[model samples]
Target: AKWREPKLDGRITEDLTINELEQYWNPLLFIDNILSETKETQWLMAQRNETGEVYLLERRRIKGVFLETLELNDFPLDVQDLTITVTSERPESEVDIIPDQNEMSAINVQTFVDQQEWKLHEHVEITKRIMKQEYSSSMKSHACLSVTCRAARRPGYFYWNVFLIMFMISSLSFATFAVSPDKAELRLRLSFTLILTSVTFKYVITQSLPKISYLTYMDKYVLMSLAILCIISVWHAIVTLLDPEHIATKYSKPANLFDLYGLQQHKSFLPPDTAVKSTNNTQNETDNFFKEHASLDNGFADNLLAFFLGSEQMEEADQSAESKTSTDNGNLSTSVGDQQNTTVPRLSNECSLDNKMACEEWKRVQIVEQHVFTSFVIIYVIAHAVFIFWLYFDASRRRREMRQKDKDYRDFLRRHQQWQQQSLRQRDMHAILRSSLHT
Candidate 1:
């Protein structure tokens, strides 16, 4: 808008100066400033032949005046007050700092006629800056710090990715609830899952941000989310490692409710654990199960319970007196033994019978563990799938609704436009008829 058309010098084709101005003051010099000079330059932008397209030489000189407050820097300077006069790349130095250059060079550049003022919307992207510390020829600057910086627009998907990442982290947290406490793999799986979730979060978020040495706001948020999940996983692992009743005490509502009701009648799971009671209980239970076949001593119940929990110790006891006697009696009375053996059961047959029962017990244990892990995993998977699907469905529904609303709005606008056009035609027709009748 501040483009001035210079009159051509009669003999020199005055447009040469304008062409020069255009080249020197190209669009890249898009700064807001007054034309600090009234004198016109005689520089030529470019030469052209007949019916020529002109190209101008582009060069720009800008003087940036800023109040460099004392608080901005911590280092020493040659002068406290300074008014730096810059023309093109050369910035003229002042022996003593000055303000508002009254005049500079052979031509004065402080004021110009009929110039338009431009407003700056944003600051310039300074690729690099040079800071000088000395003014005198004899005195060298203490240091020159050249800084490099770049400008970037914020990513359009910033908030969208944030929501997605948070949703995934929260989903992973929910995933932890799907593990069973009884499964030994639960703790490891939880830790591994949580760790992987954290890693995924890091990977996803790192792509969205600059590589600042210090963590950004979004980084802190995502890291905090991961930490919370890790804590949940760790807490779950610890709880699962503990006794079931203890865990039940900590987590189960029924256990808590029962404890509240039985608060007065509290029975200890490990009351004193006296040696006598432990030993006697173990012996009695063993006698019932083994029928006096095995030898057992004190603390057997506790030891047995501990073993069941995870002691990895098993006691192989001797066969019963009846079993030994039956074996001996069979061999002693060969004839009678032969007749008895034909009628009586053999040891091999008994072993075979017991093997079947042991195998059944093993299968039962396996089935129990399988069902527990399977149920837990399935519950979590289903919950996760449901939640993810819900997020998808909700987003889809909103988008569909928005589209519908937009369609409706456009239809309304079209109808209103048609009505307005019709109304205008009718008014014009009435005016034309009135004019004709008057004429």
Candidate 2:
């Protein structure tokens, strides 16, 4: 019922005979309205096969034509029920029936058919797209958009920009290694700036995408990278601004009741396992090493003793300390516990008189500490550098990496510069401290 061919009718008397019927039937031909809209068109519509999906009633576009409109075919119709009405039929006279002899077919019938054909084609197109179901699926997924646009210049420039940003960031992060561990301000300044940079990046990137509840991989990657860089900056800030020795004391040192008693006697104990002392194999030497050095009856007074015992240099030094103690007096060792308990007090007059001596002793300790610190710092830098290089190389250089590297590098450079400054400042403090021994 969706489509129907326009029907035609004719009436003639039987007495008018076979010749007239032959003449009427001779001119009968279906109009091919779909393709030929001309009223005087030459082509005729004839069913190729009733069972076919479409028919080439005329030699034009009906075959293999991509129908943009809804395709219509194979609908049942009342072709058999068509009835002819006789206006008049008589034996004395012949009756002839026909409409506007110049045009015996429906008028403007093709126009109506064209509108229906377009609607059918449009419906078909819509239904097929809905069934295919491709583009609309984007509503719920976080899949990476695989862009297939043919814009060469646009994508080219975009790729270049991404590369450049990443290059800069990576350079920035890499610069952290060059920062010294001493300066506190450098890390602080750099960290604040990089955090702002990351915020700006987030804002910029978001402008190009729709707001989504679930994060795309790109979003997660950006966020994670920002977090990592923030942490890196924090670490640098801590190392640069804070005094490791002071912090270690605050956090790692166990509290003890006896600390109030000046049990350590103003001695700032270095970290454990950092030095070596000698084992006194002989009874005389063993008695001096523990008995002379230990303040409490407990073995802790000679904790440094246990550390340095493995080295020959420290053993020689121990011998010197013993000789020095022996010079104080033979009776200094008379009561081992009493001698160890007594803290050496600097004399008021000796403050000026022994200025050179105190400075010399401090200089010696500083040199030893410097040697230890420099050796360990070198080892730490080598190990850490290897790790960072591997991480950078192993990871993909997405736009995200570039941004990360930029922020991280800024912090890295700041920390490096700060640490260098801290080292210089430490040296200055040490010099000033030693010089005060004279004043």
Candidate 3:
């Protein structure tokens, strides 16, 4: 409840006791939106201004929890309004509520202890409104005043801990490509691991925020990263299923280029006496051909080809091939030797064809992977940029609306003051006319 007293003489401002304040009329005012009250204290003070106008002030200090609605679409970058509403029990005809023109509402930010998480603004907003209550078809209007303060959530914590971590984990999914595409199990395992990590991190982040149905900015980012991870895993599966080398390794053992070339070029390293011994061991050689090529799997085949084809190793391999060819000509005596020579060339040609096809397929998949990664990066950047621009423009629009409201309120106060002065002058003139008529 609020009460005030007026006196004719100027006096020093002093606090009045509650018993003394009961002698004056009081407006029954209460906070309408408070959830719970911890403590409240109130006092009255009287003072006179320079113009000899006496005024009474009711000072109140209240500490309690209040109810408020928060919109979290922007989430980590969102601003919230904290409001306190005071409503009078008496109708508008018996009580009036208005902002004090001589005093401006303000907030003391120096005392705020949660500065690390939220930034509190010093400017306070006061609004006067009339609310109508209906009781059995009868209506009464009550005066209400609301004071609001704005606070913006600090995004730095979420940026580093949540968003940055999510981005890094999502990017690691791309590194799965470093593993051979034929090793689909390894690549898929890595991709799924990153995806699960992102999902768990999202849950941890969500625990810090209120449960809401709509997606926030941070939620959108996490979902985007998750989608990218899913795409990466799917691509890995697709490439593995479509790859010729992977299929060959899965169904039947294929002769790899490494075993075929290595055996042909190093055959000359055997001693002259072992040459006939080696030729006689044709059956053992046939068994070793399947064993050696079967172990020469497709993992890192392209990388090995790239290293050997572009380095001094290729020159050494060519020299070894020439020496083996000369040694073969010198030992072309037995019919079994001629048949072995023909079989080596035929096996070499088949291995070369299979290797070339697999390499081309891998190269095509690599190009597609590069394009996909670049597209995802571009899309992510553009989406975030658009979101930021929308937030910026939305904030600017809200500020403009607030300024317009303040301007309109000022105009209303000015007009109300002029109307009061006009009424006073007319009343005085009517009294003077009545006095003259009585005379």
Q: Which is the leading candidate under TM-score?
A: 3
Worst 10 residues of 3 by lDDT: 267-276
lDDT of 3 by residue, 1-439 (tens): 3233564245444555556655666687788889999999987656566556656666789999999999787777777888999988888998898887655565677999899998776556888898876652557889999999877777788889887888789778878878865577899999888988888888888888889899987898789889888988998888766554453333221223434446554232221122223433533564454444433432323223322232333454345344444444223223223434544444333333333444455556667767876876777678667756866676445444545655665676677678878977998899899899999
Candidate 1 vs 3: which has more lDDT? 3
Candidate 3, overall lDDT?
A: 0.64
Kindly give the number of clashing pairs for every candidate. Answer: 6, 26, 0
- Please give the CA lDDT of all the candidate structures: 0.39, 0.36, 0.64
Candidate 1: how many backbone clashes? 6
lDDT of 1 by residue, 1-439 (tens): 1122233222243335663455443222222123354433333344332334333433344444333323112111011222222212223232211221122112122342212221111111112223342554654322111111111222225446674666566456655545544453675676676678667767876764445565544455456566656655665665544434344345323234335434323323221112113544433333343333123332332233222221221231112222334444333233222322332232222222212333343345446546654664565467557644753464334334444544664565567678878977998899899899999
Model 2, stretches more than 4 Å misplaced? 1-157, 163-167, 240-439
lDDT, candidate 2, at 143? 14
Using lDDT as the measure, what is the rank order of every candidate, best first?
3, 1, 2
Backbone clashes in model 2:
26
